[model samples]
Target: MVAKYVMLADTTRCINCKACEVACRAEWDTPLGYSRDWVKEVESVNAKGMPELQIFPGRCQHCDDAPCVEVCPTGASWKREDGIVLVDHDICSGCELCVPACPYDARWLNPVTNTISKCTFCQPRIDKGLQPACVETCVGNALIFGDANDPNSEVSILLKTKEWQRLITDEVNIGPNHYYYTAGKTIPVEVMPKLHERHLAGKSIESIVNPLGTIGIGGMMAVFLGAGVKKLVDRRKEVSEKEDNHEHH
Candidate 1:
């Protein structure tokens, strides 16, 4: 059986140094303004009105039922058997259709490649028997990565002994593999998953065009036709609303 790769983030140890973000950017050459990973710090008051802080190191959840993979017009966004979800640049259409499908907002269009880019757990380095850049450079040692299936692995040990949580929501449970050990602190608002926060661009099209029926040129034509009709309807509604306002005047 293939190893189940997972990450255990010890939020108690995170110092908000952002070394992980810098490491990922350096390793991937991620463009300015967009990166494959991030560190979020949320400050709030407890019930006693005392100030408290929580920090989260975040990336793609690499979900088992990834909405990005399900809504991909092409089979470009796919998951390997080992559970890493990746984008095949050559097969992607640059349609930005998968942009809105991720609840975690993990996927983005790479300006350089005109293809989707995201965190892959540094799969290349992992294949080379090295830790992910973020994990390697973590100054606080908050980030831990390894195959969760291996009993001796750090991730597996953490899972067995420590209480952990994911950024999962009750409404949108997708079987995310990332685990968080917060040491009983309230989860930061910045790190919790919000399904309504997902972009609507790709999701709107997916709602209208059935993926199973989209088989070839005929399906492509349906997308165009559906979009045209929607635009026309919106235009007519705008005109009618204008006419009603004019009459009221």
Candidate 2:
């Protein structure tokens, strides 16, 4: 059977050690300031007025209907058949259009690559029949990764036997694949999914390019379209110059 990959976070067992964060950074050689994964600590008061803490390990949800894929003009963002969302760095223009499209804010522009970057579910490691770096390094065994479509897969079994919830909001419904076990309690409002405002280019596309195509009236939309064209041209020139410089050296 074709495999559908998924990740599970058992918040009940998490220790908030940030091991996953460290492992991901090391695996990807992520820049000093950026990370592909993070563990968020949510603090609140319980019914007894006692301190309550919830730790959520987060990364790209690899949504079935990914908005990142939709907003990418260069088609650099794509979803693999196995449910991994990835950036094709070779084609990415570093436009940062996909960054704001994600409700989870899981993506970022890598300083080194100058391209959109996000969690890939450790595709390279999985291809070698190994677990993701984060999963392998998890101290408390709180993270689980496997094929969700296989009835015998650990993730599939867990979903069937345990209660879980995906981060979601009324404004956006992208069908995220990441599942969190919150122990039957409602997730905190701060950590719940929220749609971020679209980038200017994305807004232009939605309001002007898509709606009017080549017939956009004299307005900020036209200005945005012109600026977009200029940016694309500049990018091509930059790449060409870089290649020429490399040849000269």
Indicate which candidate wins on lDDT: 2
TM-scores for candidates 1 onward, in order = 0.80, 0.84
Q: Give per-candidate clash totals.
A: 0, 0
**What is the lDDT for 3 in model 2?**
82
Minimal lDDT window, size 10, model 1: 196-205
**lDDT per model vs. reference:** 0.85, 0.91
Once fitted onto the true fold, the runs of candidate 1 whose alpha carbons sit more than 4 angstroms away are: 196-249
Writing each residue's lDDT as its tens digit, candidate 2 over 1-249 gives 778899999999899999999999999999998999999999999999999999999999999999999889989999999989999999999999888888898999988989988999999999898999999999999999999999998999999999999998888778999999989988888777787667887898898877775565556687998999999999999999999999999
Question: How much RMSD separates candidate 1 from the native structure?
Answer: 14.4
The local distance difference test score of model 1 is 0.85
Model 1 C-alpha lDDT per residue in residues 143-207, reported as the tens digit of each score = 99999878998888889998999887788789898999988876865677767333475555555
Model 2 ranges off by over 4 Å: 214-249
Q: How accurate is candidate 2 locally (lDDT)?
A: 0.91
* Model 1 pairs whose backbones collide: none
